[model samples]
Target: MAGPTILSSPSPPSEEAGTILLETERLIIRRYFLSDAPAMAETGNDTLVTANLRAGFPSPYRLSDAEAFLSTACKPDGTAYPQHNGIFVKPLTADNPSPEPRFIGAVGIIPKGDVYFRTWELGYWLGSASWGKGYATEAIGPFVRWCFDTWPGLNRIEGEAYGSNEASQKVMKKCGFIEEGTRRGAAEKLGVLKDVVNFGLLRSDLEGVKELVRDS
Candidate 1:
């Protein structure tokens, strides 16, 4: 809980062009920084942390894994999602009024194709210690609104979680996402098949949730 500034991405200016720095009442959703690797490794290495996540996230998440992620995910290049951002706590410093917050999670939406071209898939994960505190709901409510408000081409956003991960569904619901049903046995995590519970949020839904940012 110490930071006078948001950790800036190490990528070159050209590669960091569209990188966003988002702030909420209690969170700072910004670009991943190289210095955050150690913390990322610590959190990413925990099995409980990645339990509900896909296999794409390394199990024994190492410093190298963190390094690689920062390199690619934080780059300004088009490889990463146009709006991928990090989540940090807004901690107060005794000496400084605004210290750089601690990195606690990651969140973003990736656009899709075909008839879904105007839609984006939302994804997010918080470290073990940061859960059950309404951080995800608060961050998501504003993030979803930002996407719809900032980008006119986007009409809808998609989200999915394992049936076992009820917390994720709740966050989605609180943030205005509708339960669209589930894909049975769509994912296998920890040797057990899990259903993928799908959710979607429309630009229209953002209206009712605009107060989320206001309340914050």
Candidate 2:
């Protein structure tokens, strides 16, 4: 529900889109499939979930939109999304052994361009039922590690939340992202303009956290 400093020299697109389907201790962050459409429709269509997000996330999100999203997300080896390697899908599921996990949320990055090749914009959303759980923070830490591991050139990943989304801001902070700053009235949603709060994690931040983890 709300978006990096990017300054890099022009570089060739990487060899291939990362084939990462990460399994964290509590989450299965992976690609989207046809089966995810219903749950995606359910969560994404909700204004409660989308209230803080961008307009690209349509209100009254239809089954068609989910279908389209899945279709686009599940692109082939040849078909790629518009920007860089495209917004790869990462629909999170509980890591329970029983009662097969369902798609409870989504996460991915929109790669930046121009002077921002080494940076990306991150985004994610969880169902209201999943709120108050540590899922966002839990999912992001590994995702950050995955990005650093998979795309060696990427230096930072950042996200923006509406100034009102304090929960999301806290989630980012808990995941080791720094509170960079805010842009006043930089976004408009539902006929009103709102300020945006920015949060970010850099490769150096990940390295620092890993060192702390090992030290402890």
Candidate 3:
């Protein structure tokens, strides 16, 4: 079997206000750089990649679209939402570390409004080339855990996927999200309506699981 990979990038200035946010065995999650636009364009251009995603990403995603995304999703210093990070492939060899991590996917959360301020809606996607590699499951675990730890008042993290998107549901399940409910005909893509399946992980649920592991 292949060995694990590590990702490294040039450290920005302390005053620059940007740095890697998290790391897993085969991935590094960080803020988006303007230089990453080309890769995002390529990945988002694939229909299979954006097929199940929400309305934001344009079909045949162009470089302009990628630039726009970086503009909105990342601050001028590239550290807009620390939790909504770009997924990059780590280096396969320690001696030959990549100067810039390979952009492959992303994981992010959007805060709910009004009465649901304590809840966050989760979303993620990967290039088709990176699919079936267990990267999604690996990336989400740390990301979700970090969200709960960073915000003391946060109560729940929720994820919704189209009913046919079993792969996404599986990733959420692996990250400890429970199937809370399904909204029938709640989503429409390409003029077709599909059921929307919802999953959630509570702060208490995560704490309980950790407690169980410690006791066992």
Q: Largest TM-score belongs to which candidate?
A: 1
Report, for all candidates in order, the number of backbone clashes. Answer: 5, 5, 1
Candidate 2: clashing pairs of residues: 1-52, 1-53, 2-160, 3-159, 3-160
Candidate 1 per-residue lDDT over residues 1-216, each given as its tens digit: 542222132332233532445577777777666777887888778788789888989999999998888777766644334455678787694322556677777887776756666788998999888888888887888877766656666688989999999999999988888899999998888899999999998888777777764453
Error of 1 at 76 (Å): 1.8
TM-score of 3: 0.83
State the lDDT of candidate 3 residue by residue for 57-169, as single tens digits.
Answer: 89989999999887766564332335446898887545227775778888877777667877888989999988998788888878888667766667899998999999999
lDDT of each: 0.75, 0.68, 0.76
The better candidate by lDDT, 1 or 3, is 3
Candidate 1 stretches greater than 4 Å from native: 1-20, 78-83, 93-98, 213-216
Ranking by lDDT: 3, 1, 2
How high is each candidate's TM-score?
A: 0.84, 0.79, 0.83
Return the lDDT, model 1, position 57: 90
Tens digit per residue, CA lDDT, model 2, 99-169:
55656778878878767878888888887767776777777677667667766678889988999999999
User: Relative to the unseen true structure, what is the C-alpha lDDT of residue 185 in candidate 3, on a scale of 0 to 100?
Assistant: 97
Candidate 3 local lDDT, residue 70: 78
